[model samples]
Target: MNEQLQSITGVILAGGQSRRMGRNKATLTVQQQSLLEIMLNKLRSVFQHVVLSGSQAAAYHTGLPVIDDFFPGCGPLAGIHAALKLCAGRGVFVIGCDMPLVPPELIRYICNCSNFDLVVPRVGDYLEPLCAFYHRSCLPFIEQALNQGRYKITSFFPRVRARYLTAEEISRFAPPDRAFFNINTPADWDRFCALYPDLKA
Candidate 1:
């Protein structure tokens, strides 16, 4: 079945501790809306089933269901694991909650790539795994890696039919750097504000 037969679930990775930012990055705001709200709006624009990959469902009242990590303390890979199970028999399109600048167009492009078991973007030498797609076919690999305590998100990439979007390809929607920009610290937040000075709140 293709992405259509089962539909891809849009997952927002919101379980981060945000140690560097020194606050809940998901609650940080732009134009009066929280980063979490911004990411949710982006996902809702592209997918029918949108959810948050976080255990603190009580903290967020976005109206969308939040799926807790099945492999607690396993990092982002745990979120992906829970998402893969929730997709029924398809794949998932996921993104980090701190990435408020991510465009829905880029997300759509990733979701369109149904031919690969893993679809991610590479900007320069770094892979944007949070803003990628993972198929159910990747379940076993993810499971094995997590079970073995190899929680790195890319640990199982080599074992799957992986596809990485080039920086040039990503430029069609937004600058590769801008599209995947995530706020991890106060300095990064300042940079984002400087990058978009007009953005209030």
Candidate 2:
């Protein structure tokens, strides 16, 4: 583990309902590795502690701790809220399980920017909140948001100190399109397979 990441706990936001994909995306495989496994490999290389945010621990079977949302059914905000609670004031490096393309070098760079409460990547108007680092200082705002039904992942961003990695900065590690490409539907899987045709079978 990188010493700079000792205070960070890696979190995989795997609680998505997957209705659009028509199956649990986490179970989908690439080159014989489950999406969850692929996501774990990306995070485990940078942080000592890694966890999944889901309904049941056994559902993932990854052996890492799975935290169920305290504000059940809310959304990714709820998962981040619950994971932040367990960080004990440490920051959380969160990524969605559907986002199998994010690289660890980007994760390490973001985690190194610990001066802000959030370290997110932005492409003009879009923010990659799911593939960002969230500080525990965001908990109260997140709590208020969830209570008020503000379930968007970026709902609490306004209230926290945030550093957005620009498209130019993010491009150094990987192409912006592939770095953030997430598999949400069968069509999305087809697109990913097109890029890495060897992984399709």
Candidate 3:
């Protein structure tokens, strides 16, 4: 696992068309730092290489490579496929741009596990596929799904060697509910502000 950690690359999925936020979510500031910058800092602390998977290259500002989705508008699956292909390794840690409240320890823990083709966390019944671990070997399956017009990130799970981190395990990494808070709409942002008023100040 340690050996794999040395080879694991971090991939930030930031190519979303944030219609709900009425702006680019990647550029949205949280506590004076853009979510992209926060995620990059967290990723850089543990991974050997971290790449931003999105359309805006300059917005990343991390100096790491920026990978544009090969199939635009196909959603997170396309971002996963592109990261796996562009990464200089087999396993990659993936996260979303809106997930500003991501626990850094959770990411480090994910990087510590590499035997499985994927390591995804479940928040309640919903699988947080956007923030998960994926191997390059799954690219073909993803490509196949994309070709079939299936854009769901979970569509290829049945064919892969996946390990699902239950809500119980997720709580271990992110206790008291600060692990998977991803902002989708303006309401979510307002809620975050209410929850973490210091983050806004």
Candidate 4:
């Protein structure tokens, strides 16, 4: 673990309704580990303080602190807002529960570059906001967006200082597609299983 990452908190956003998968994606199993477990282990390796957003603290038995959405039904932005509040003064690395294969190396890179209010990855033209870094200072802007009923995570991007990792930079850690791959449906899970049979779903 990098010493610099000690001041950072890791947050796993597990509040999604999973309408597409028709099940709680966080509990979905890959190999013998649940998606939540996989992300928890990965984040615990680098961050000293790791928490779950949108899960009941007692639900997992892992002892990690769990925080529910402060603004429920507001999408991931609310989760991000809650995580920022939990982080307090420390920076936070936020990743969705369905993004099971997010590379630690990539996380390290993002944290290393998190000098601004936000540090996000750009794969081609799209931004992977879920697997990104946020500073506590972003709280105000995020709160404003939520209060205005703006749910898109990028709704407040223009109002903050943000750093974006280019495709060339991401390739050094993992393939672009695999790095940000998130399972939202049965077919997506099948695709992941086919790609990594040893870690079959």
lDDT score of residue 76 within candidate 3: 81
Lowest-scoring 10 consecutive residues by lDDT in candidate 2? 192-201
**What residue runs in model 4 are displaced by over 4 Å at the alpha carbon?**
55-58
Q: Report residue 192 deviation for candidate 1 (angstroms).
A: 0.5
The 10-residue segment of model 1 with minimum total lDDT is 1-10
Please give the CA lDDT of all the candidate structures: 0.85, 0.86, 0.79, 0.86
RMSD of 4: 1.8
As a TM-score, model 4 comes out at 0.94
lDDT of 2 by residue, 1-201 (tens): 556699899999888889999999898988888888888888888888999896844577788888989999888899999999876547799899888878788899999997798999998899999999988888899999998989998877888898999999999988888889989999999999889656321
TM-score of each: 0.94, 0.95, 0.92, 0.94
| C-alpha lDDT (0 to 100) for residue 161 of candidate 1 | 99
Q: Model 3 over residues 5-122: C-alpha lDDT tens digits?
A: 7788888887778888998778777668887787778788778788888786546566778998888888889888888888887678999877766777777776666678888887
lDDT of 4 by residue, 125-191 (tens): 8999999999988999999999999999999999999999999999998888888888999999889
lDDT of 2 at 81: 93
Best by lDDT: 2
lDDT of 1 by residue, 1-201 (tens): 234524788899998898899999899887788888888888887888888897864488878888988898789999999999876547898899988878888888887886799999998789999999998999999999999999999999999999999988999998887887889999999999888766421
Residue pairs in clash, model 3: none
| Better candidate by lDDT, 2 or 3 | 2
| Model 3 ranges off by over 4 Å | 199-201
